[model samples]
Target: MNTYLQVAAADASEHRTLIITLFSVFVAATLGVTVWAGRRTKDATDYYAGGRSFSGFQNGLAISGDYMSAASFLGIAGAISLFGYDGFLYSIGFLVAWLVALLLVAEPLRNSGRFTMGDVLAYRMRQRPVRTAAGVSTIVVSIFYLLAQMVGAGALVALLLGVSGDAGKNVIVVLVGVVMILYVTIGGMKGTTWVQMIKACLLIAGTLLITFLVMLKFDFNISTLLGAAAENSGQGAAFLEPGLKYGVSTTTEIDFISLGLALVLGTAGLPHILIRFYTVPTARAARKSVIWAIGIIGAFYLMTIALGFGAAALLSRKEITESDAAGNTAAPLLAQNIGGGADSAGGAILLAVICAVAFATILAVVAGLTLASSSSFAHDLYANVIRKGKASDREEVKAARVSSILIGGVAIVLGIFAGKLNVAFLVALAFAVAASANLPTILYSLFWKRFNTTGSLWSIYGGLSSSVLLVVFSPVVSGNPSAMFPGADFQWFPLNNPGLVSIPLGFLLGWLGTVVSKNEDVDGRKYAELEVRSLTGTGAH
Candidate 1:
């Protein structure tokens, strides 16, 4: 009996059970929110688009919640700890994408759309076919993004509970999938937004609190922390300079550029993020939401800068190693090390908060993704394709609920399979695909009057094909021997990311296709008139 108790205590010491318990409570609270939201989900619009009643600020907060996932939270911190200056590249890249969204897409997207990005593009050109393609793209991107979050969740749970890998991730997948389904299934956009708002607040607060405390440990000296971080960051001179690693190798520069493009252009194109704009009531509200979202997300990213450096300076040696070299666990493990290395209750509280934030982040983000995919399948595909354009609101809502469950199940299974993949790389692939397939069509539909059905089709096909092919040949996919076409694993390309190449290709194809198909047959004036009314709210919604 004594030996068994000793074993239990040791497990507690290693696993940090208290943190896991706290995380469970957070999930319970989110579930309660989901239940409340379910009560409000009464019709198709409510279930699929939150009845389009959200104000700018509410929607903005929800966007932040949706955009900031495990990859941003834990993966960024881990990158900073292990890769130093290279990690900040991601932060810069991520922030740049918002600029693209604000300048090029936000108001036009809100003005043009009801549910999906496909709606925005196909509104004038070829509604049915364009909507179909957009729906396919949204689901594909959401699944990729979802799998990354699920993998991160599993890693987090296993680290916190010291459980077997499969068990820990499966628990997160089930919990997150169920909670997200409930959020969209019940409250619809309204409910999903509320949950995201609460989670975003919690996440920002938690990160800020940790950053503050870590600074306090150094007498609030920022430079001192940086110096310490530089000394401990493992890569020596490369710790402070971006191009010092591998002496500006062609491969390194290519990867860095790809990362930058993904962060910038991809932010504007993600289906889950784009759909949040629709939750707002007006185009002005959508634009306002973007500004607020930028501020909140910028502040959160700023704090991560501190958190990442703090982990490297204080816990680098203790929390990481060469064999298990990714350093993804640095953030939570560093928290534990802060208060006597997971033994003290203080450490437990910190771990619990971070873990809780992680759990909440996953639930909020995944719910939004599921909701986006569900909307695409239900409203875009089913109503338009399966129903011959006559599906009722009741049918759409029911189909949405059913689709939500199916997509969630797929994400859970995929997340489990992608257990060994890099969280950051998976997310980057989602961005690449979104930039390629969705962005070009949306942009041309809004701004270019000459864009016709052929242009839109070619853009979708070209962008989608290029992004997928690039990813297949990119280092992450090809580097894996077990991946299909293992010989392709030896990358011929320099960039690890494909957004730079794929996004431009999407735009070029759309333009070329437009030119080819516009020899006096296209009604450019009528399309421009439609766009003008949509942008200024001069016509029917």
Candidate 2:
């Protein structure tokens, strides 16, 4: 029952110092890579899409890095450790979401857009409004996703450094923000892509190693691992079955469905992930990258079962919860235990390595997010909307760099307040907003010829506003002990996630906006051109 291993006071300082030093070295190495990549980034194309020089496998690795965020590693592993079978649902929903991206969005998005998703939406619609809406939606979604990565960084690093107070976590969050801003402004897509590829490889390797150790701990028998997790989790048989977490009440069940919907549909709409397609040379390369990504991400997610259950089997519930209430520290703590517990030199080294990988994960993800949002601002709103697409490449790239700083600042502030929520849960909010605002308009634009500016504007703004408002009033924000503001009680919406309601509303609003529009500003010729370009990649940039 006392499986929660703690370092002796004398060794704790030594462990903390080692972890910090190793982590610093990794950060410095990544920054050097970014600086080197920045030297090659000389144009708008290079800044926005990494010169489109990355091969399928490289881009796929980068995409895997972007998708397998802090939520995928720290959050989901923790979720599994704490909630058992219900926790595994997050991984399932996340992995399954990629199929939707591969089949419906990836190739077309790559073939159609140049720099940003706004490019595709603005191609046929009124340039200003659609691009503006897209830029706004991209930034909003990116910030939401960024919060999870940033918060995960705070929780993980705080635990690694043996800094128990909010002050230390907040400082780490700010440091992460500053570092990510540097990555985006200096590295652009080229730097960001390389960082992501490295992170992805490290993350997968780390996960595999831990998984192997966990299996070995149980003599490589999965059933044995599951049984130990069930017994050790304090939930007995229920820990291995449904309703341990989400099905406790009718409201919670509906919330689970909403969360599932968001996770399934959100990836296609995430600006950072979508932009990775543009880093490849051609539409075929984009498709190939996705296939590679699916394989990497799939394998990594499968190993999360071992990581999660391993933590449950090895660490007590109180140990996991007390480390961090949301269980974000479970993965790193699990690593410590399997590496010979806290007192051993092996435990300290392994813990430092895994946490360093996690820190790198946060940095890579946040940099991608900042780039996506800042690129949307520079490419869509500033160049196209404000300057009517006449801005020089240098000017636009400069604008992106400037905007990245601002966006990074906002993410840091929001992340400090959102430290208590689960990173995976925060990502679901991003997903709900993306599924509501971005995905509906994207699908309509690609498929429906009648989808015009009115439809685009309506769906985006309606979906964005509805989903955000619902979230602001939902239990995730307030009304519950686990809320962002636990003392307040403003929740009126029953579900924790808004995807179930806002997703349908988005599609319906798009149709209604087009059908009822009196302007009738349909650009038939442009639609035909877009369709041809999207299908055959004849005129694709």
- Among all candidates shown, the one with the greatest TM-score: 2
lDDT of 2 at 238: 97
- The top-ranked prediction according to lDDT is 2
Can you write out model 1's per-residue Cα lDDT over 95-205, one digit (the tens) per residue?
778998998888877776777777777667667877778778888889989987887777776666655545666786677676667777776777788899998999998
By summed lDDT, the worst window of 10 consecutive residues in model 2 runs over 1-10
Looking at candidate 1, the ten consecutive residues that score lowest on lDDT are: 1-10
Provide the overall lDDT of each model, using Cα atoms, as 2-decimal numbers: 0.76, 0.92
**How far out, in Å, is residue 497 in model 2?**
0.7
Candidate 2: segments with Cα more than 4 A from true spot: 1-10, 518-523
Q: Report clashes for each candidate as comma-separated counts.
A: 6, 0
Displacement of the residue 431 alpha carbon in candidate 1, Å: 1.3
Candidate 2, residue 49: lDDT: 96
Question: How well does candidate 2 match the true structure in TM-score terms?
Answer: 0.98
lDDT of 2 by residue, 296-379 (tens): 999999999999999999998898888789999899999988999888888878888999999889999999999999999999
